[model samples]
Target: MRSDVRDRIERAVDLMSTRMADEDAPPSLDELAGAAAFSKFHFHRVFRIVTGETCAQALARLRLARGTNALQRRERSVTDAAFLAGYGSSQSFAKALKMQTGKTASELRNEPHILARLVERLAHVEMAGGEAGPRLLAIEIARFDPFEIVAVRTEALYPDVAGTFSALASALGGTQGVTAIIGRAHDDLEGGVDGRPVFDCGFRLRAGDAAVPAGAEAMTVAGGEHLRARHIGSYRALPGTVDIIYRMILGRSDLILADRPTVFHYVDDPGETAEASLRTDIHVPICRIASPKEKESK
Candidate 1:
């Protein structure tokens, strides 16, 4: 895509994200085109190219996501989740939820059926509706001490993050100080600036005299409690694993999401690993919400 054209599309998508975040809905077609600075007649064509979905389709997906999260995480009742999700009633919200995810409000609320439903949903979406071969996903929690990294940033999508890693590697001339290579997504592509996801391709700095390269910046990765999941197979499937993680998170009453970027630690060298054999460990920052009794005591 032409840089100018891409920039315009990103600007419009950014606006859409802004509307979605603030209002739990999307703006009208005229508003979208205005945000893109294009004629309404022509903007849709370009937007479809950039995002691969109509404005309504994309926004609806985002809306469903908000409802799902709110229903799961914010102590919202089903009715509240529906209203915040822009639905007229809880029944309508339940129907839409079933249509999009093949699960009910109660199932989503408690996840009594999380395992059976989530894995199936993950495979179908990640495989693009292909036959769902076996997939493995597991979540665990661990405490991380403060660590450092030498990293480079880009506005590239996750699939294209390899180039940034290559550039960082070449700049450093070798992995002398590196303990592990990790990827950090700084923004959601759907809600990111100009609709482009920002990512950091970084090497974990070992505890030693490892020097930071001239071009890359040194920073401390967060240290705290994290919910981690292991992903097996292609990097493209990582999003599916992420969906499962969020679903699990929503079902929990004792855990609330912490404000931090989810980080992926590369467990295998993709250069030498088969696509099906690739291993990645994903870390989601989190905190334990005190129980009601604990809160009452405070």
Candidate 2:
């Protein structure tokens, strides 16, 4: 990525943080455009190009993500969350919130924690459209280590995984970190048998040496055995590639998937499409599925 473009994106994120901080603030598009060093006419398009959403789309997403987080974990009131997220009134927030989620604000607050998780997961559907690129280079077991990431996560399925990844990358602006899409490609893990095709998709962020920014918290990937593969192709073909990898490797039973697969786009270039040169190293954490004899021995 060009340093100039990278700098502008960081500036845009900074401007967004400032805008969100002011409770009474109604920031103008012109200010955001200036902060991004983009022309007012082009800012909306450019911002969407870089972040996978228009400025308004990103704002709503961030607001909702923050509001949901507050609603579920912080025990904060819906009224407070509404205002904190720049909503004019709880009524307005509740209407939109209920549209996105089946539950009303008060209902959501009283609902079980699982309901909140359901809401969080359902919110990711809008981020999937993005530029398609070429396949990622192959990777091996020695390439990565257990590391930490802080991210704003969602569960919506996107039209394009590459676009979803781009939003994750944008969310990490101003930080020295790699934004990666974490997910399990398919279930069943059996060869030649098309089983259920469900996987977990979320973001993995690595905090850099720089001071951690507000609202970015830390989470860790535990150390364990993993099955690794490097895929080189268009984004659309990844699901099949992942399926193929599982069939070949897991068929041999050298590893069994401990959880979902992690698609690591370690060398993503923000300025270009994946077709220009795509590279994502996928890792599925695994352990030996104990045999009957092993269980008996234990």
Candidate 3:
């Protein structure tokens, strides 16, 4: 089979579209992977490579986005929204949502999920390997609902990051939390306007907080609406995804981009050797753009 990354990504997106058609009923991972003709083991990585998020994370975000839309614009119930998102139990979902978002689902529905506004600015920074010089990139809008993630986190920068991660992994001792090491990049794709690329490299815990790495933090993804997609391949592939989102906004209705931080949601362990290349889920928090008239009034 041809190893065309775009083709595989389109297929994965198609599968996601199909799954969202009926939130109450969704496709299994194996079945979904089959749609893209990807290996069950390697499919998750491929999906992440193309879309920048894992299959599970994308699905959950889609569900939450739907639910957020409903809550904000319509008279929707949390339970109904949860059920539609394929949640087995609302209580469990809500609990996880509160942790990631720093607010309950109901709270977001009632109030805006705001990040201190960022100037709609553009800048440049270097890549991780230090091979390339600074490149121009912008931090765009993103919005996502809370989801569960088991991660090892620390306040460290690159080069030293690997060692810090090793120490964190050792401290974890296979206890609870994330079972896999997932990298979450909350900074701009351009490494932000600053030279430092802020990151939280951690593994998903198995059960409890006991497995949390020393000096690492554990939190649930706040439940709410999210503007998300998959980013296939290395961290270098992120810029393309951002461009696509901007184009989508231009073509779609007057959905203005808002100041929501973006997230690089990892699908597989970067340390794991796989038949396929690396992959990650790219998510941004965005709100609808206001009309010219609406903007003027504001």
Candidate 4:
């Protein structure tokens, strides 16, 4: 696909995502197509071909994902969750939940482990659109010792990750010991859309003398070797960038993925920076296999 066409489709996807996050009602097909500057009919065909799901299917999945988060909240009743998810009634919400997750609403609420499994399953569901980007700018490998960090954890959506950084900055309070500002995703985009994802947004802490704030938690990033890539542009394009990286990782026989969550270091403040100029460094952990000759010698 042409890069221009791919970018247009991505713009449409971004619009749809913004609407879904902001309002209970999904945007009309005409609105989405218009956002892409395409005719409604042609947009429909291209959208499905590019995203692998119909527009309606994509909307429904997004709604169901949001509903899953609401249903899991202890403070919100099932009826309340259903309404918040834009469903007319609890019956309809329950039916949709079951259809998507193979579990009833009650089952999800009462069984915490079941709910966890459901969240994991949802996290793996790709937003059915957009081909992966053709390339990443520069890839590198780096190693480091475990580093201490002070951060605030939130259940904010992926789009809000940048928004949460300010709170972390405030918590840091111009401390001279602060290093790089980092954001780590505890769940994937699917999990984030479902509202169950946890993100630790904060800065790396240098040694000594700085006091940890009341609400912030201090933790360490496990020291290890990792595959790194620099992503430039909107955070919304991260999934595609990540997809390309994973593809590259899988294609190599001598590389082994580590059991670790991916880490993103923000190079620019999203709140102060335009989306088009944002920069983030992504790190994926890996273990390298020794060459056959080296293995034999060992």
Candidate 5:
């Protein structure tokens, strides 16, 4: 496949995943096509060819998978789960569950062992290997001290970083003592793409450098431990990298997501380096494991 075509499909997949994860109603075919910048007919044909599933089928699978997770985690009642999963009623949700997994929602909810088995099954289904599987070069635990930065924010999607960064660079105007270039994603993609998500493109500032440009603001990145993964590729492939990280976290009981946004540290300048050789360190904030007693109480 052509690189441009692959990037378009990836963006479509990301949009689909976002909507499904948010438990929102599936988007219309036109919406998906528009997101990919393709005509509706061509987009449908290419999406099926690339993903091996039609748009509707992919959405259904994701909804059922997330519904299973919710049942296993005890996060919502059956009726509530049905609504969130885009099913009209508990009866319809149960029927779909049985068709997909050969088990009813009540059975999975009432039986701890069965729920565990279902969780394991759903994990494999969710992270099934694909052509654009994650290519993370390394993973590490790192600590960052609080640091200030001046950023220009925008409500754009991935692969559109150049414009946002350019705006920030123009704002800085040869300011001295820059530490690093960073991209911060402020929205949870898993929750549906409703309005545009916010992205902050900026440079880390030196200590005591309090000069803030007009139309820009200074903010502090909190100090804490984070799970960092190094991704070596084009910015277009970052979604695949993030998917892998989420799968890793799901497989481990010791890690829980923190309430902070994910950060990307660009280690190489794109203008000087080829896209294939670019490196980005993605940091996801995480919390330590909970005790078994604490788990039981919850």
Candidate 6:
């Protein structure tokens, strides 16, 4: 990354935070793109790469945050929150509240604890489409601790990881943290997979001595350098988010894509948590830049 890339992105996020805090709506994508001095063509990709959210996600988060706060305020009626949330009516707002928070609007109003997690998650609950979606992305390079994972590899018959993950879970029912779903995809699937794609679907072992689940294989992952970001709320948008990150990395001069596969860490259980409150972290392996030949490749 250029020295100015991070600095400029940080400035853009500061601007976004300020706008979200205002009583009025924020600037459009075009506006933020101009401010960032990043090309409009790559703005969304760059923003999502650095922030792990689309412009739409950012807008929805702010709208929901403001509305949820209104719900908690004694003076603010559900109607007030609805309008504050950019919803046309309380009915719509309430529907969104339940979908996003898994609680009625009344429940959130009466309980403060629930709101805290929502804020922490930065989840979005949009009733309808299209806010110019001028995107909080704090994209960072971080190291994950070394760990061992017991996972099921996708078979010829089972190309998708869904069934593989399920079988692993059933086999590991006795294991702790088996409910947490995590995966690694070796292929980008950019050009399309060769007969079957490569995916290792399962849980990271918490104990070193823990036996690998009957049907799974154990491997040690070094978990070194990776581009990391948090995506709170819903896996529905995950595919697009990952694409955006890939585009940004491909277009960048500083990024050196590592040989290893990308890791998807599913932070929350959608079955147990609301769709809007689901948490997912994407870890894109990155190579450390050093040699002049490597730097000169750009």
* TM-score quality measure for candidate 6: 0.48
Q: Better model by lDDT, 3 or 4?
A: 4
lDDT of each: 0.67, 0.52, 0.50, 0.69, 0.69, 0.64
Candidate 1, superposed: residue stretches over 4 Å from native: 1-137, 189-193, 296-298
List of clashing residue pairs for candidate 6: 51-137
Backbone clash total for model 2 is 14
What overall lDDT, based on C-alpha atoms, would model 6 receive against the true structure?
0.64
Question: How does each model score on TM-score?
Answer: 0.55, 0.38, 0.40, 0.55, 0.54, 0.48
TM-score of 2: 0.38
Tell me how far the alpha carbon of residue 141 in candidate 2 is from the true structure, in angstroms, after superposition. Answer: 4.8
Off by over 4 Å in 4: 1-90, 93-133, 174-177, 192-195, 291-293
Q: Write the per-residue lDDT of candidate 6 for residues 1-298, one digit (tens) a residue.
A: 3445545556666666567657566766556766776644345444555555556566667777778877667888999888988889999988877887789877776677877666555533221222212222856888887677788776332224556766776787743665356777654322111223356787876654457767689866668888887777656566556665555564466665665667888887555799888778888777665668866886
Q: Rank the candidates by TM-score, best first.
A: 4, 1, 5, 6, 3, 2
Question: How many steric overlaps does candidate 3 have?
Answer: 47
Q: Runs in model 3 with CA error above 4 Å?
A: 1-166, 174-182, 246-253, 289-298
Candidate 4, residues 1-298, lDDT tens digits: the string is 3444557767787777667657886776667767876544245445554566656666676666667777778988888878877889999989989888788988888897778766555433243434434767699888778777888888776757655666666766763666787776655533322334567887887767346787888877766988899998998887557656655654466765565556788887666799889998988777798889989999
Q: Clash number for every model?
A: 0, 14, 47, 2, 0, 1
| 139 Cα displacement, candidate 3 (Å) | 18
